[model samples]
Target: MEVHAHSHTERKKWTHYLWEFLMLFLAVFCGYLAEYQLEHKIERDREKQFIRSLLNDVSTDTVKLNNLINVRNQRENWLDSLTYVMNSQNPRSFPPADVYYYAIFIPRSIPLRFIPNDGTIQQLKSAGGLRLISIIGYDIGVRNLTRIGEVEETLINDYRGIAHYFFDGIVFDSMLDANNIPRRPKYAPQLYSFSDQNLHELNYKLFSIKAYNRASRRESKRLLQQAENLLTILKKEYHLK
Candidate 1:
């Protein structure tokens, strides 16, 4: 009877030890799995951050490249203007040779397709003459009147149009006052007329000087400076010269 009781005690101890071993093994396995999952998550987050940083760097570089191109283009245009003036019959009429300052206002709704061809731009550039060609506030007909609200949209559309027409830029010259309106009003009849008369490739700027009713010299200068600042920013930001 003593021997049987000892055997039974030993069996119970062995069974308990086996169960404890299995529980410890399972706990270790679970810990390993949890650690592996956490590592994978951290790795993914790191990759995402790396990709985002790369994209931002690429964007910044693109902007810088564009600015550099614009500055170069502006310098070239200035040189060309000077050359044109030197060869012109009357340099006084071509103020662009010396004066690089002007304010050009583009309308807000005209599509870029309406801009004349590159010949027009080239002619203007060669002439060293600047003018504003407005696409808004002109009476195309008795029923059609150009509207002005969102200037940027009109500008982009006009840009596209000018590009399509092979024009390097636009000119804003829409009549704003009732007195300035002609009897047979048209949208930039002068530009359209020029476009029709001369089929030349032109690459020049869209130019304008805002006509104010009672603008003082200081006010006019301030406005002109503001336009120049905007042009500089556009050149730097978007590489537009």
Candidate 2:
């Protein structure tokens, strides 16, 4: 009876140890699963936030572009009205004020150098339009047509004189490098750093606008959307009412 009782006690002890071990294993497994789930959730939230931020940036840029276009249209309309009045008064006797208008009232250049030629400039000027030349920068290397450095050199050289002569502002194309350019990362530094030399040589009231690239449509759209949202926030924050 004593031996049987001892055997029974040992059996119970072994069973208790087994149970404790199983429970501990289960607890560790549960903790690991919880940690993994929490990490995954955090990662997903970060990605979503980044996308939203990029979209806001893009939207703001779009709004700025729209505002610029509206201003240009208004100027053009005013010039047209002035031209009509001068022409009605007397075509030949229309004062040399037209020349002054053209000298000042040209539209700023786009990335493609979309500027009216001398004749068009003269006509618009005569019509009392300002000679605003759009400052443009073209990225040449993407299509393998020209090297980026070569293009940059040419643009700098070509526009250096033009900058002084005709350009109202400098529009830099591909202004930011791939890394520095806005992306999904919350705190990615600018991909391309602007050299002092480039900045000094291309000096003008800089208007940094991204040129439309087919390859980056989705990203661009997201960024533009983000930009627009930011603009709204800025307007409100800055009391730009």
Candidate 3:
């Protein structure tokens, strides 16, 4: 048998191998850049969505604050009227009906309270998304609002305790109509007691409550301003309406 001849293959040059390695590296690097860009875009979109939701919440807060401010003003006036009538040397000189009406109104009236909408903020906190927002001032404003609300609640509780010493619940119940609305009595109503000590203590509680209400009103106004400021910032930062 005749022997077969082997064909020799040419070896690749070092430069050719280096060129192939460089092409692989370039492909990997380009793919990595593309992936990074896509992730960045997604995050940006999510941030904008969160900002829009926040704007809605803040807008609602503004409306509520406005209404609460008006209520507080009216309540303050009522408190002033009651205190003036009670401060007299002769409490009986004032109309019994008027005294009874204001006395019952104070403790029976519901507190003007506000609860913030924090759904988006809570979501962001849970999802580690607070980093998306650059402003810290908005958070501070919310905390201040919450603090004032707490103080107001505490003052209300104290006022209630003092009111129990001054007014009778039976009188309060009698003044309410079937729908729980206050109506003037056809006959003049009598106070539980016209004791000087009770009147003095009641006056103190009324003044304290008024002070707390004024503070709360001021805080609410500040918070409203802050919310508006935040809205402006969000709109400008995100180029939103």
Top candidate (TM-score): 3
Count of backbone clashes, every candidate in sequence: 24, 35, 0
Model 3, range 1-241, lDDT digits (tens) per residue? 9999999899999999999999999999999999999999998998889989988988898898898888888878878988987777766677877766766665543547777787887888888777634335666667776787777677667777766564666776787899887766666665555677887777778887788778878888887888788888889989999
Q: Report the Cα lDDT for candidate 2.
A: 0.38
The number of residue pairs in model 2 that clash at the backbone is 35
Writing each residue's lDDT as its tens digit, candidate 1 over 145-229 gives: 1121123244434434543332113322232345432122232222122252122222232321111101122232333343344
Off by over 4 Å in 3: 1-6, 92-101, 108-111, 131-135, 164-166, 177-187
Cα-lDDT of candidate 1: 0.34
lDDT, candidate 3, at 15: 100
Off by over 4 Å in 2: 1-9, 12-21, 71-94, 107-241
Residue 28 in candidate 3, Cα distance off native in Å: 1.6
What do the candidate models score in CA lDDT, each in turn?
0.34, 0.38, 0.77
